[model samples]
Target: MTQLTPSPAGTEGARDAGDPLAEGRSRAGWWHARWVVPSALAVGYALSVLFRLSLVTDQDHPTVSPDEQMYLVMARFLAGRPTTEIPGDQIIPSGYSLLISPALRLTQEPVHAYHLIMGINALVSCLMLPLAYWALRRLNVSRPVSYAVGVAAATLPTVLFYTQYAMADTPLPVLVLLWLIGVHGLFSEGSGRRRVWFGLLAGLAAGYCLLTHDRGGVIIALTAVVLLAALAFNWAPRVASALALASLGVMFVVKKLMTAWLMARIDGARPSEVGNAVFDTLANTQLMRRTVMRCVGHLWYFMTSTWGLGALALVVCVYVVFSKRFGLADRVVAFLMVALLAGITLAAAAGLPADGRIDTITYARYLSPLAPVYILVAMAALYRVRGWKKIAALGTAASAVTLVLLAVLLRLAGAELVKSYFVVWGLPDATFLSSLWPANGDWGGFHAGRTTVIALLVLAVVLLLRLLAGNRRAALATGVAGLSLAVFAGVASAAITERITEPRTKGTQGIAAGFIEAAGIRPGDRMVMDDGLVWEIRATMTFMVLDGRVWSRALNKNAPVPAEADVAVFALADQQAPATDSWRNAPAGWHVDRDVREHQFVVWRRR
Candidate 1:
């Protein structure tokens, strides 16, 4: 049903059809070589992701608490249970929780239910693999390159580790990638009717993107700008853009309809949650100004996280934008990625409340959905390289390495001994980026963990230069860069899992989960969380003793406790706790069942 897209996309893609890697396409048996190869590759990638996530996702407890706790609470609420969080704090979207809700029904134990959600995470997140492979194909990226990038993208710790958490990020990469594909088809397809279909498809993905994560708003905004570009340039059919946008409008209508029914069942949730702080970002010039340093910090750290492929990717994107040699479609996609990188980085940089820690430098988690671009960027740079463009890419990459080395030097010079601050903000454990400190100092004589990255980046640039030399040079350079990145990513991700991600649930938090249960809390108990307890304690209490009927007293200490709640879970450090600053202990008229002073926790029952 598909016809050749307009040239030079068609012209360039036709050249790729003769690629030795795609030789099988000539033999179109019943299996249909075009679909068969990509399908097999997709299935293989999906299974690998599922298997990889399975090994580490079955944790005793959540590592990224509060965020995980919030998700769990949201899931239970979606699964026809009572609200678990304080009112006004539930600005979080329920899109990911909708997926997690089904798993809660499979087991009574909170941990088991969490594990089932992890399995669900693996399943839903792996959909990105197939979608990614298909997206690359739609973009007319060569078959071998598409499949290779698809598999390579899965190897990133960002792609794997987040699945262990119940955060919306688990499914974002796929959703974002799929939306981009729809945008491409909506604009570049030969048939006007097919274009409208693609537009509708894109819009649906865009709607889901909004639901899945707050960053989805940024994605939607980026799409709006891109669609406008399509209109101005006459790149897309007017009907297609209208249809794509209309689908997202329908999504809003659906959300509004669902909100009223949901509000009745789950308390404390906002009428509808869409974008958070997005308006403040645009209106406040100071907020935008403050984001500059943070934005650069986020980008620098992300480059480090990607092992320096981000630099090459940036160069490739810039080159694509200016180079008319690339077809309209290729350039537009390139522009989209580049824009997304900037938009996400800037948005992430904003609203990092003035904190003393240098957390931004280690924060790479924000733009991780763009992980696939690392290898793909270098590969694009390799594709159809000219003398001037190759020079420019190499020069830019070299400059990036210099900047990286300089940043490390500056860090060493102005370093603080805030070892405690290295604990990550979201996933505070060793599983996250902040925990990867340059130990023994950045100037540890001949050895520093940071130097290893710099060296690799320098080598990658050198290899790219070599790659541009000739066919013989290209073979050696390509093989070394490709194989090295692949092996490094695999080993690094595995080591991270073994040394870090695995330990999070088994550490203090896991012990705490058990402690909470042993301290007189039981599975499926209706619990009330005292407002005076700290966030960490609250997260653990909510997580360990879930019955879907958990309610927060919120900020009102005088607020009446839920009449049906069986237990009041309080922390020793709470304001109302005994021996607190006010010398207060226990809520009035409550009976203390267990005063576990050693653990700084207590369980109480209503009189």
Candidate 2:
């Protein structure tokens, strides 16, 4: 059956034939608010992907966060290792790695393999834009707002940044969005067969999401709750509702069990009692407040960057509830939006700890998985507001003035919101706002943070005034401007971030590469790293040159070097030279090497 799309507000199921803009396809031409909008969005997304691809070529290896490095290693394992060599227990899920392993199999070169994995990630992330657009359209959002939603998903800095990195941050959002799309289909389709198929698809998508990241556990739980609510309200027939609920619940459980089995197999053993004890200890309540605070900070940070989309969503929800203009579909979207935000917030708060200090960088990464939802709901709210043209122009003008004034005032005061927030919370001030701080400090470090706060404040005030005054046009304008500023801020911030961090990441890669080259290590050569080198370096080494066998052995500096080793790298406390005691009586033709990071590499040759 052909998908039925509701006509836009004025079209009444058909376009004005005399209007030249309506001169495409049949009565439901994609250019007629359904297809054209998503197509345009796809074009924009493609451009962004191209831009990201251009940046990727600048470095020998793609930039990787620590988590990304882990995924890359897992991908490598999946790509090459024999089934028997796979371990029995995995701390990290392999779904994402497994998804990208095909790229690795196609290429033997580490850099090429890394590019392939990131290319796949970028493609998936780009596809999310259209997925979001389709989902919004299915939920009956207006054409303009759906386009905005798609654009936001495509261009948002966090979305774009992670897409270029080899991590599940990009994939999870797409998966969750797919699940939501399936859920929407399950409810909206009338045919029993179609409903059943949609239900199955929804269940599969949710399960796949769960397998990709533990965060999907929250999505799974939310699915059951939503299904229960639907059943309670008689939203669907008993048989259909029961089937979907059961299918989703069963899929979630099956995925969990399957993942556990796969992880155990890959890790070589299940987690031991000691590991569980440490996990329990680390999960103590004393850390909850900090984690919650950090997550809250991240949410606020995301909202600010997105032109206060979260704030706009709140106002829209309240208005929808009171105005009684919302149809069932709209109401459902609103409810699902709230549930997802709450679920992710609580999950972030509970699932991670601040680790004794504010790690401004890492916690924000968790929020990227929800970026598409945030963009969708925010845009959906805007679409609900009518007569936005004049108000949008006015709001944009007002926003420009507000931004200038705020920047001037902030520059004079020299205040940094990040420091203030930390001081209030009594946490060690980390100085940098993980996702908010302009990466290059190009915008005057902390000045950018201040400007962001002011921008959010302006957008919020304008939106509230428009809403309270019952000026729907102005409210619409404010929403549009807010979204516009959101894209601008996010894109600019990401570019600065890349510029600032690229060199450092490249430097790290260079150091690892230098060590590998100097060691004269060849394919299959055993290269042991000192235990103190940290996983970051170890992982980088593993990715930089995939051929060499790498391991970290907790050997003392004085211990005899393994005669089987071709090379050994040691992480020193400082710029200390390698002590000869470890290899004093080494076999003939042994020598040591150094890298800029104060690491010592020794290469051993046989006579």
Candidate 3:
């Protein structure tokens, strides 16, 4: 929200002031740069919101991925359940569900509650827009470049995809952004009181980030690393460094102590198997190599998905590091990025499955908090690129890289490399770019894939032009167009994926809900479900009636039915329909009361 004074017309540098083309371009740049790009960004925000709405049905409500149900179940507990009863099987922190609780408390309908949670996520995630702009401005990036960065932060496919879910990923970028800005302020601000306040605020933001997700601990650790780096290099005042460290230490210790206490209070209620699994997973270090490999792969896909912004950020950070005039804040930002890299690597290590699932899908969400910073660095790099010759050099290099990448992708179209990249990173698990540039089909996916790349390339080309003509007009126009296209790509991708996948997700939820309804599952009914059922169904049932008498038994072939239960639910492996036959292995005296076809689950009433 910082106000920037629009530079006067023709004040921008000119290569040939007497040349008609140069003069005209300068005037055009001045004219468009002031209003057009920002206006387009505002429009992108609106479109992003609408696209989110399109994805907000029961099918895509939380997400088809079972993790969303866990958040919902946790939120249900926060809304109206005893601490002892909350499921601790999932090791995720409670901050996200706690955020969703207010909305749930206001609405009994699950769908309405989901809508509110999505809206909250969208708003929180959108905070990146202002934060990006402000961060770029702080770095002395021009208005035009900064606006593009803000727009990109608002419209990137990764940001949009996560916003549609009720996960902790959405709010993380905002918290990270705040922590970055706060750290930046500690040295930038001159007044002692203001610096103290900034340090406290930064620490608080770091603490909250840690509480929201385990990756948040990375922020706090990164801040401490920055302080050490600063002291080692004599970058900032000793007093300021001390204050920042003190504030962070207090918050970190306080949060850990409080979380430990709360865990103890709820410990007796959690299943012993859950505790055993968590501790066992934490102690294992045998898979360290696999964890590192997945982390590296995750970073690669993250760069690819974000339109090469990650590469751009790396280029800028390298430039800053090698620059003779780089200062304390520059080192802070650079080290912060390093800390993130280390933290993320550590997170992936901690999250490695003892069962060897070892996929990086969840790690991408952890990496999302770095997106705004990536945008800021890229924008700043673009802003610093001056002159026609320099622009051409950079553009040529960029174009060459893009061409080689595209060619490699085409050549490897049916190869395992492309497929494995998506799998390792836990992407949709479909063929890479299959939805967009389908190897087996048409160009209809252009809006989902190529348009975004084309737009960014266009923006890159215009950045080169700005170096020669210093025309803000062309830069602003192409930048806005590029960003608009990116937004379109994101919305189109969301729509396409939703269309193809929502039916299955919705079908599962509907079948589960329908079966429960048909079986007349009242609040106090003793309901037995297979302990081996997907977490989604179990969590969904718990969320349906927080205080219900739900019990889990290993209801597989020959497993005994709970004598105290009035009803039970079971699911079969793939291709088998949910029916009485699906439960043929069930103990005698159980009659199928309802069958959920989509999910292959059945409810049985004791006869």
lDDT of 2 by residue, 552-596 (tens): 555554455555666666554544554454344444565554343
**Number of the top TM-score candidate:** 1
Question: Which ranges of candidate 1 are over 4 A from the true structure?
Answer: 1-18, 21-39, 86-88, 229-233, 255-264, 271-289, 386-392, 395-420, 424-452, 455-469, 472-484, 510-512, 554-559, 573-590
**Candidate 1 displacement at residue 364 in angstroms:** 1.5
Model 2 TM-score (2 dp): 0.75
TM-score of 1: 0.82
Between candidates 2 and 3, which one is better according to TM-score? 2
How many clashes does each candidate structure show, in the order listed?
A: 2, 15, 6
TM-score of every model versus the real structure: 0.82, 0.75, 0.74
lDDT for 60 (candidate 3): 27
lDDT value for model 2: 0.56
lDDT, candidate 1, residue 166? 76
Q: Please, what are the lDDT tens digits per residue for candidate 3 over residues 331-403?
A: 5666677558656755654564533332342245567667667756654555555455655554455444444
Residue 114 miss distance in model 2 (angstroms): 0.9
Candidate 1 residue lDDT tens string, 319-427: 6778776666667777888888888877666644555555553355668877665445554455334354554556467456536644653464234313314443332
Q: In model 3, which runs have C-alpha deviations exceeding 4 angstroms?
A: 1-51, 57-61, 82-88, 143-145, 228-240, 261-292, 354-363, 392-425, 428-504, 510-512, 523-526, 532-535, 547-549, 555-566, 571-607
Question: Which candidate number would show the highest lDDT if scored against the true structure?
Answer: 1
